[model samples]
Target: MGLECIRGASLAPLNTFGIDECAEQLCLVHSDAELREALALADQRGWPVQLLGGGSNLVLAGPVSGLTVVMRSRGRRVVRRNGDSALIEAEAGENWHRLVVWSLDLGLHGLENLSLIPGTVGAAPVQNIGAYGVELCDLFDSLQALDRRTGALCWLNREDCRFAYRDSLFKQQPGRYVILRVRLRLHTRPVPRLDYAPLAAAWQALGLKQPDSRVISRLVCDIRRSKLPDPARLGNAGSFFKNPLVSAEQAAAMLARWPGMPHYPQVDGSVKLAAGWLIEQAGWKGHSRERVGVHREQALVLVNLGGARGGDIMALARDIQQDIERRFGLQLEMEPQLLGN
Candidate 1:
């Protein structure tokens, strides 16, 4: 049975940040039937529902109103298979990293490059999650979304989702649909992407000449472990700000001032500036305001050292925002889902 809808449900355990906020109502959905029932209950009670994933990419700013449906839908399976290409589908609640490892165990290649990212499989498409020169869109075959208004399940192909740099159509329409299951197109024939600067640096640093997909996966995980804080130890949303894209002329001007600026040329004739570099340039690295601070190792990540209220973290983010804008003449948008403004 699902957790009965309750008043003042503790939310500290629901978010990675471990903030002491309460949800006005709380419920869990383990299957499609229960999801529909929860939607009906919300409609009848005039209470909005907050759909929670693994709670890895969210900040609970204050006590949330209405019901929360923590997605607990479970299971992962090889939906279809061929000689080299196969369709791997996972329930929304399956741990993302676990699924990645599962695919690798099956000798699947496409997902190996994305190992160890935090959060649920369903949320992957919500932001078209990416890392280490690879992206969810690189393997995303399609997805099934449950429409909130009509309660109808519909399939969305790559074009329908409109995936783009850390964005997708579903992310645009928050609270409007539930991602039920995600399907990925993985390959048995291995091909690894190891051209990212950090990967190459790590390889050169370790005296490695060539690394396959699995080796690249392990290396990427190692690099991420060194930079990012474990959620169990510290409260943080990964990549608090998105890398800002600027015109080539603007990048040249900024390079003149900073000289050692790090960036990549986008296919659309734009330059992707590192948000971490910008934050560091603005002198916010290792900077703290009471409970919240910029992670010294990864300035792009805003961290909760201890008992940080989301508002405090947001204020620091705003400060970072102002500073980056002032310094670089470029604005960086936040990456986390902010609840209870």
Candidate 2:
């Protein structure tokens, strides 16, 4: 019922990368009161506070200092339901994939395309998580967060969150707000989004008479399992880099040079280039050096081949970033947050 504290906690098991590092102090808080108490305790002791969720989307760069607070709060339920529409709320600690399945079980649509993403509900808006043809912002109604600056609980709407491509207000101003829970607007009527080519093809292959959210979710899981590695078996943070967006003119030039290169045009007169394709083209796919390597199946994923340190992972990532920049004149931004210096 209170904050569970540990000193000199090993963080290797917490992160997906399994980087061996220790936090000076770690607190696992299961409720808002506990979280606030943990923060107050850290502040009183003059220890810097670092937040963590599922640990699926971060890089433990080195041994962390001060107090590390892990959000472990949990709950999920339908807040309300209207004619063919519903509003659902979930506590921060709820697993993302499980939330998707829960929604489907409730006959809710909209989250099927984002079924297999890692991390918890609290971390979703931080990265504006997206997959297949859907993004979290599409259904995000609002979220309850503790604003550190004011020490007050606040409700932030979709526009208030300032959601963008893999970005949000929570990410823009880190350490300023702690997301406590999230609310989503979903539909009871089937309105599947299969805009992604591969998803559409897989759906077509099924040849079902009508769209089924569960079936769509299964297909998504199947696709993700095939492309991404299981963190338990092979230590990895899925998709190490964000797909770079280039100007229309830049995209035209790149297309002219490599006709086979994959590109997706945005409504904002920009083109999104596949980061994995660029990395593979630069000959880094399956490339290994002692303990770290690029995943053979997914060039976007950087894997830790047992006994790899945080420094080793960053070194590989830097090499890949440099190569992609040199080869394509594009910068591949890392998707995972670096937790330490």
Candidate 3:
């Protein structure tokens, strides 16, 4: 069955930011066949196609004069079980938070730390979503995607995905492959990560010597709530910039300037500076001009205080980039994808 394609589709409802935009041709594809058909139609029309998952990470300023295919497909099931771990497959359209809850119910423990993060499971791999000492790649098995150029479904292993900090192969080569479903290998037994600051603090407060994955999940949810604003009330993507990683020498130099600095040592021998702290120290915290502002609770978040345009957010982001560089000599990169280039 192909997509029952429509003309003049409004994208405002599809994206979480709710910026008023329209796709010349928009599709709500429930199946991969429908997705392929929609893409084929977009190809024939010479209009570039954008694959939208939950639209939580997108910023749409004005009318998108092209084809935007929103994945409405959804499902969760165990494809195969391997001893204590099983290969769990989720359709591209499955709500990410729901999937986490479902996994917890099934006694799967790996995805617990990623609870309450927005966007569909299909889009998680693109940015390698991580929180509280866990990343999506830790439990990754493989994923299936439709290659638009070849018009064939292809399977990519973890290595093929080439995931990095807030980056993946799909994001690197955008528009080439549309993710259909993701397969994860999670442990039946708990392998909890509690090394992160907030999670550890939450555990200490709770007075638990050895906590399970569920405890970490609850802690993460509470910490995130206290830090980041709810997107429904205030329009904003989670984090606006990637935590900049600098060399040891650079870190030492920065420490010389500001002795009180928060940093985490990366696996690749680099130091990940706290982007939120940098923004807060730069005096951008709670900074608002009209509708656009940096979140008061967490400076890493940029908010749309009603009627804020995407351009306004972009300007704020640029201002942060400039300020961070001028103050600390470290450049911050955007985590969200900017539309309407």
User: In terms of TM-score, which candidate is strongest?
Assistant: 2
Candidate 1: worst-modelled 10 consecutive residues by lDDT: 203-212
Measured with C-alpha atoms, the lDDT of residue 222 in candidate 3 is 88
After best superposition, candidate 1 residue 73: deviation in angstroms? 0.9
Give the candidates in order of TM-score, highest first.
2, 3, 1
Cα lDDT tens digits, model 1, 237-315, are: 8899988888999989888888888979999999999998878877899998789999888898888889898888889
Best model number under lDDT: 2
In candidate 3, position 149 carries an lDDT of: 78
> Local error of candidate 1 at 172, Å?
1.4
lDDT of 3: 0.85
Q: Candidate 3, which segments miss by more than 4 Å at Cα?
A: none
- Using all chains and alpha carbons, the TM-scores for the candidates as numbered come to 0.95, 0.98, 0.96
Q: After TM-score superposition, what is the CA distance of residue 146 in candidate 1 from its true location, in Å? A: 0.6
Prediction 1 global C-alpha lDDT: 0.86
Q: lDDT for each of the candidates?
A: 0.86, 0.93, 0.85
